[model samples]
Target: MNKKLSPAALTIATVVIGTLGLASVPAAATRPGRAAAVHVAAHFDLASGQTPENGVLEPDGSLDVTFSVARQVARVDPDGGTHILATMPLPADGGANTPILHFAPTMGIVRADDGTLYFLYATGTADLTGVWRLRPRQTPERIAALPADGLPNGMALDRRTGKLYIADSVLGTVWTVPVTGGTPTAWTSAPELAYSAIAGANGLKIHNNALWVSDTDDGTILRIPLLPGNRPGQLQVRATGLTSVDDFTFTGRGDEILAALNHPNTIVRIRPDGHRTTVLNAADGLQNPTSIEVRGTTVYVLNAAYVTAEDPNVLVAGLRDLR
Candidate 1:
């Protein structure tokens, strides 16, 4: 479940934002935030704890997340404590467990207007499959599924058209699927996972009339316009200095984009005008953040520590304490 700020906490946050606003009366300030400490509300797949994957911050501040433990998916609070939702048991001998266990725990998640949650999880273990939906506040039911080929790793939903943009890691393609549950059509293909290839197609979000994706293998932020006609056209590289850019998000006014890179384990802020600045290091902001979701002034990141046997995801928050 998502954590709700108490009335007192909300009041305090508002005051903090007000104070920060005073120092920003300047013309155009483009600096990443200071090294702020993030509170870890949930720890998934911790050695001794539960396993979780993609997560979303409910509009009301509750958590709607996924836990890929076996063929079943689990939903819990930010603290990984309360059980808010869960999926029906997976079919017996559904498929190979090795691949599914190796590649995906769960790749991405996007919420719909009616509070429905959509996600991309492993088909057996290694397959990067299609989109699946669960009605909000109810036990998860299979609404739809995408292709199991090419390893579909990242996903984003356009609220305007109800279309989903999916990035495939192996085949180097990004496709779009209709929310009404139909066949997904290809959008674009690339050459180099870095300069053009679509390696590690990890995270994605739709904002500012484009679909933003994190290509970790190539360490770049890719964006394609979302004009009319539902076709993804004109791909552009937004940011390029990071070693391994994973998940990213847009700030308020859709002015700034935030990204977390691997290797050095850092977070960077990319200005709308194409400027780059450091936000935080591994010590301060995150470990290995995989995806991000935003709701107004708050930014929620899933710092998925993927090395150890247990896959733990840390939630780093940035609350716009605007005065």
Candidate 2:
């Protein structure tokens, strides 16, 4: 933890976790090829931290990153602003006593295409749900089971065919594990399932080979067709009247799918022929917008707000959409 922000912990985290600001638009108030008026840099760093789990570009974009602090994972220092290098602990994997590192954390801070840095954890605390791997430090590797009620949201690892797409969100199911290292297979979303399926299945990206899913209670954004014994059974419902499809990114230019449309705060871009665009609305200044990370033109939104004592949603990363 980066510590040093005590104003009573910054007024109990700005009156109980609330940090949402980023509605830039003034590179000169646009006009020329349009894309400027979006001004975002007004001080709300709130110590710069929260549940942002996936943002990379260390190859040399100068920085440009974003990640969860833990309980999933966190990292983002991509130059421009938001600086939070690293903070990890907890995540012993299905063995339990999690101590609580990265539970239900899909794509929990990835970097695998062989560059290897894939660290995901799943241990719903007790019942039994584990999928762990932390190689940079060398002592945490448990990839298996992970079905204690299963709420593991969005995980991806198809570096062409390494296969590891998990998104069980309370059983709507979509599991696949085959880093070539053993067993851990369960992919069910077939015949019929996913009707107001509750549980909150955030996001999962696997473009091309197709695996994109987001069913935060059917706000829609699904597509499953990953063969090999198959069974991820037919779920093709791409984009609907989304009002709660929080977190999605391909805006890296693979073409279309920007989605970070939480509640009212927006950031939808979806395309691939279906075409849809909003860029950013909620009048521009997002509030509950949680988790989003695009590198190119810069789009990092994580407007958070959750407060509860004995264990609640607990996400406190305000916003920062610089697009």
Candidate 3:
């Protein structure tokens, strides 16, 4: 959830941005030898204040994004046009305060094979906070309600089982609910998943027969072995030293992972051998990049530009030849 910026939070964020010198340098400057062929698939002007947090690439190649500040979900066409899909309705009692920041509405989103979209959003009310589904030409329907303290974020689906996995940034817990609609149960929880001062479990992915999750505050990516019967086995650290990691996806090779590291404003490729490579950075025109999705050999990055008060853009880079 993108919390409403309070005076103190704004001041702190400003200090952090200034300390990093991020406010002074433009995003277009390329780091020598680190440049990848990048293009702006879509650009959202600052006037719109559309802080796109997370998104999924659709079957037809369009990208669907969650505008945190705008409280709406929109589809970004292949040519970069944006079409609003749904505006979240406010809760009857005025949604409950978000866990920490109390910022914006939608957080995590995923699309099923049949064009059904499932998203996790803040309703400002405990009872209303949960997963909601939207099928084409159909009204939005609430499917599950998480605990009052749950601040749900990244999501993944097990296509074979028809189960959806959700990550709670605040409580450091992962919950699973059937796509057909049912109660959500805690799939797993640990000290590593809980939020410290910043955030906890942010992005989730099921790859290579295991569940991979990034612990933002702890700067670690954990791989939990998925056993039979939808049970989770041991939790092992796959990679570390990733500060403020957000959404991530498996590369075409399947042996490596691409992640959006928000704080340092870079996208990194983590190999199974624990080697990390900088694929793109602030120099490559990334601004507080929040999530990443790959279609074939093309990589799409959503830049929230959260630190800067202006001009957030989406960047697309081709990796077919590079790979």
Tell how far residue 248 is off in model 2, in angstroms.
Answer: 2.4
Candidate 2's residue-wise lDDT over 295-316, tens digit each? 6566555543221111111111
Residue 190, model 2, lDDT: 48
Residue by residue across 223-280, what tens digits does model 1's lDDT show?
7787677766678887776665767777775657877664344667788777877655
Off by over 4 Å in 3: 1-27, 30-36, 92-96, 320-323
lDDT for 175 in candidate 2 is 72
lDDT of each: 0.57, 0.50, 0.79
TM-score of model 1 vs. true structure: 0.74
Better of 2 and 3 by TM-score: 3
Better of 1 and 3 by TM-score: 3
Q: Rank the candidates by TM-score, best first.
A: 3, 1, 2
Arrange candidates by lDDT, highest first: which order?
3, 1, 2
